[model samples]
Target: MYEIELLINGRPFRGAAEARTTLADFLRHTLRLTGTHLGCEHGVCGACTVLVDGVSARSCLMLAVQADGAIVETVEGLAEHDGTLHPLQQAFRDAHGLQCGFCTPGMLMTLVELLRETPHPSEDEVRDAISGNICRCTGYQSIVDATLAVAGAAGTEGSEP
Candidate 1:
């Protein structure tokens, strides 16, 4: 077993895992952070997406040891400590972007990266940013709308014309 340490969701975490263990398994099984889901396990479905060192990554495709000393962000980190939703999360709820919710975490993390880089992304950019994530339930329009809503709110906040 290899000992791994990561800064997860703004907190430090340490655990031991086999060298071959995927980061998804380490997060879910060892660290008990179940918000990162596993689907397909081949890095195609994107359900196991997470932010590593501030970039979106497929957790299932990353080994636990490979992520040692990296900073990681999961869906659980999106909300405020006092239970307040992040703007993107609130927008998703308002826009009804999620149905079954299996893919919401990945989508949220992916968009989090996108919004950080492009605070006010166009509809096409939002769609392109999330193109890697596959959501079987919402058909994607709602998701796109939700991202745009968040971007729109950001664009309008504290702006004077």
Candidate 2:
């Protein structure tokens, strides 16, 4: 067993994890943070995406020990302590960006990084950023629209044809 320390959703978490434990397993089974879903464990599907050190990463592709001392953000971290939804979350709801909800968390986490890197990302850019995630429902247009809605509301919407 290896000792691991990580800051998740602004809270410091320390625990013993096996060397082979995937971050997704660590988060879900060990920490009980079930927001990070596991779809394709091979990292092909972005369902296991999370923000590690502020970049979108496939949690299933990373070992728990690899996240020692790293700052990780899960979907649980996107909302305010008082329960107010993040703008992106709200936009997703308003735009019907999710249907089955399996892919929402990963998409949200991925777009969080994208919006931070490019505050005014174009529609195509939003699509590109979320290309790694697969949502069997919603057909993706609503997700793109939701992202654009947040960008426009933030006054940082970029023009893309």
Candidate 3:
């Protein structure tokens, strides 16, 4: 087993994992951070999206050992400890961007990175950003609207955990 150490949700974590262990498994099973879902283990689906070192990445596509010394952020880290939602999350809720919720986590994380890079992304850009993530429920216009709403609102893209 390879020894790994990383910062997750602003907290340090140390653990041992097999080389083949997916980062998603390490977060969900080892650290008990279940916000990163595993919809498609093949990585086609973005259900396992998370921020690694400030960039959105597919947790299932990365090995746990590859995350050693990296800073990881999951959906759980997006809100304040007092339960205040991140602006993106709030937008999602207000715009009804989520339906079944299976893909919400991934959508949130992906948009988080997108907003960081492009604070005021256009509708086409929003759609491009979420192309990798599939939501079987909503028509996706709501999700785009939600992202645009957040982009248009008071900036909360840089909220700290």
lDDT of 3 by residue, 13-67 (tens): 9888999999999999988889889998988889999999999999999999999
Model 1 CA lDDT for position 2:
98
> For residues 38-121, what per-residue lDDT tens digits would candidate 1 score against the true structure?
998998988999999999999999999999999999999989999999998999999999999999999999999998888888
TM-score of each: 0.96, 0.95, 0.94
Clashes of 3: 0
* Model 3 segments more than 4 A misplaced: 155-161
RMSD (CA, Å), each prediction: 2.3, 3.0, 2.3
Q: Residues 30-126, candidate 2: write the lDDT tens digits.
A: 9999999999899988999999998999999999999999999999999999999999999999999999999999999999999888887898899
| Residue pairs that clash (backbone atoms under 3 angstroms), model 2 | none
Instruction: Give the Cα error of residue 126 in candidate 2, in Å.
Output: 0.7
State the number of backbone clashes in model 2: 0
What's the number of clashes in each of the models? 0, 0, 0
lDDT of 2: 0.93
Which of candidates 2 and 3 reaches a greater TM-score?
2
